[model samples]
Target: MDGTMSGVGIDIRDDGLARVTLRRGDAGNAIDLTTARGLLDAATACERSGVRAVLLSGEGRSFCVGGDLREFARFEGEALEQHLLAVTGALHEALRVFARLDAPMVAAVQGAVAGAGIGLAAAADVTLAADDASFTAAYTGIGYSPDAGVSWFLPRLAGPKRALDLLLTNRRIPASEAVEIGLVSRTVAAGLLADEAARTAEVLRDGPAGAFGATRRLVAAGLTADLGPHLDREARALAAAARGEEGREGVAAFLGKRPPAFRSAASPF
Candidate 1:
């Protein structure tokens, strides 16, 4: 099923893939109140449908330029403050929902990526940028601060010093530099961006879903977990996975020298 809500497009495929596109391309896909709510709705839909993977992309030249400053400019004083709070509240909740999903998300970014756009890209499990893409932390440029998990994601992805440099300078960096600094997974030719992202998402969708979910949680937790406790957690997860349908099928397939049908195997996650 496919639907367009405000400035966001959601397409849930029969193969368990959710394609979420930012549809306000003419406005550089800027996030307004409606767009923020739409994203939350889309994320909620994907979760309800139990999609195995998600692919995020834009409709036009730019992925997203960040929050709609033009919209914000219309309000003043407490009105403006309240408007911003609503916007960030919806956007941040959407990000949290996406992050907690068992499905992995892949983002295909092109052209300009700035402000909260950086947060969306960084939040993805894998971010594929086109060679023509460029990134900038644009919040500081407008006398605003970071939102949409940018402050948290940046430091973790690119190191504290680099994150601070990007945030403070608001300098645009090429896709090459983004990959080198661990801001993105890899860069692809602009023409191939869509196809490559879809291919990657398809692979993830076909993999073992339950194991992927557990692994995702484990990796995120490992960042702050101590070695001893983390190892114990890993042991419990491994043991549980071994008894699951996907794991049993995987082992059987290996011994039989056959490819495992992970999609057919029921996932307990």
Candidate 2:
């Protein structure tokens, strides 16, 4: 169940709960060019594995510190812009894959969640933070605009005003206040963060697969789609879920007074 895939480490349970951990803890789990590609590779593997849920975390004191500034410093002008483009391209691909997957993402965040790290954490369908976990939009402080989908995810998550406040001020917020501001779903004791995240992932694994995925899609589309097309999308999604195996099993199980065994479904993406 445990192996290294690209620069990321994966542990897949028989029940289809996959753990995707950032492996460069020694370096604060910074996202270098290699790590960006590694993330895409790991996400692709997860899709192929038919994972029902994913628990994302890092191996050390920090969840992720964002891009590797040291690596960025190695370039200048056009070289820097090109390097950034390459890094964001890979990172965006990974994020897109995860967003399109049926499996729900649960991020177990601790320590620092800064810059692009903030985007990574925000992208999760649900995020569980350690009591000591902290969040900051470090992009502006470093004279950079947002990347890694932070600009897209933050406003929807923390509201436009609050999102801009974080982006412009680069103020660090503790986990407790993070929950208040809708930055994280919940906070747990630092020692129990792993267990809590796994429990959340297991809950998601047991959920009705197509229905859950459809719900995520509906919510996301509601943010941008016009009311008419959004409603059409929802209708189609619901009908598709109703025609799926999990939907039938769910209905039958309810009628029979039994637990539904909702198996993992391959992501359409």
lDDT of each: 0.94, 0.88
lDDT of 2 by residue, 47-141 (tens): 88878898999989999999999999999999999999999999999999999887889999999988888888989999999999999989989
lDDT of 1 by residue, 1-269 (tens): 79998789999998899999999999999999999999999999988988899999988999999999999999999999999999999999999899889899999999999998999999999999999899999999999999989999899888999999999999899999999988899999999999999999999999888888899899999989999999999999999989999899999999999989888896322
Candidate 2: lDDT of 233? Answer: 93
Candidate 1 local lDDT, residue 214: 92
Residue 183, model 2, lDDT: 74
Candidate 1 clashing pairs? Answer: none
Judge candidate 2 against the unseen true structure and give its global Cα lDDT, from 0 to 1: 0.88
Q: What 10-residue stretch in candidate 2 is worst by lDDT?
A: 260-269
User: Who wins the lDDT comparison?
Assistant: 1
How do all models score by TM-score?
0.98, 0.93
Residue pairs clashing, model 2: none
- TM-score computed on alpha carbons, candidate 2: 0.93
